[model samples]
Target: GEEVAQTPKHLVRGEGQKAKLYCAPIKGHSYVFWYQQVLKNEFKFLISFQNENVFDETGMPKERFSAKCLPNSPCSLEIQATKLEDSAVYFCASSQSGNTEAFFGQGTRLTVV
Candidate 1:
């Protein structure tokens, strides 16, 4: 079972502060993706990367959100200058891209003041 795991299932940060989240992908995985779910309803893809390079980041916020996929260190999402609108559940997922389904983490629910 290759499932992603995220920490701090919930997070709270005041405006202008920083928010950091962690994600542990299934062992032996090489591709990781990050997404933001607003209102716990809809999902918005933020970024995707294979290995340590940026694959795509079409839906990411231009002001403050960044992600990385490192070797066995677990992917991470860092958001600077938090805002009320930034409150949402951040999901991390990984897949082998062959016969495996994309596995998602429980997500980190971030709340901003």
Candidate 2:
């Protein structure tokens, strides 16, 4: 596809439930990133991959948060145990290269209660 696609526009999870989001990057893109947007104007980088390999994960949570990018499959971000603070929008972005401008998906909104 020419645009990045994200699945399940909205997700509601209990405090201890698991939440998983998927993103299909534009064909031919080599870099993918997952970001969490808590506030309307604030975005926190969660992780990034370069052709199915971890490129950077410095902003990923040490626990409960995990992600993956694999060949022939869409990238994913999973939360093992949802927390109240985990309520936010998860956006997936992809770029042709690390220095190129990224294209973002519509985003998945997760609400934990």
Candidate 3:
């Protein structure tokens, strides 16, 4: 069984500052996804990649938010300018494909002060 991994489990930044989140997809899994959780009951998919190529990005912001899943490297999700409203838990997930069940990492809790 494969599992997703994220770094900097918690992050705090001033409003208007930059915030970056790193994720290492599970070994052997090709699909990588990112999600933002603003509330306990809400999970918003941000973007997804299949083997270093973007597969779907329907929920991602056109600006500020960017992500990459390059080969041989840990995937990355960055917010160019963090706002107070951006304070939330960011989760990274991995799966074999879109149809497969996803395995999520312990979310990265980001706080914009």
Of the two candidates 2 and 3, the one with more favorable lDDT, higher being better, is 2
Model 2: weakest 10-residue lDDT segment is 34-43
Query: What TM-scores do the predictions have?
Result: 0.91, 0.97, 0.95
- lDDT per residue as tens, model 1, 1-113: 45788998999999999999999988777778888899858989888887778888898886898888777587889999999999999989988762467789999999999
Better of 1 and 2 by lDDT: 2
* Top candidate, metric lDDT: 2
* Candidate 1 accuracy as TM-score: 0.91
Write down the RMSD of candidate 2 (Cα, Å): 0.7
- Cα RMSD of all models vs. native, in order, equals 1.8, 0.7, 1.3
Instruction: State the lDDT at 99 in candidate 3.
Output: 73
- Residues 34-109 of candidate 2: C-alpha lDDT, one tens digit per residue: 9999967599999999999999999999699999998999899999989999999999999999798999999999
lDDT of 2 at 60: 93
Q: Is candidate 1 or candidate 3 better by TM-score?
A: 3
Q: Which stretches of candidate 2 lie over 4 Å from their true place?
A: none
- RMSD to the native, candidate 3? 1.3
Q: What's the residue-level lDDT of 43 in candidate 1?
A: 87
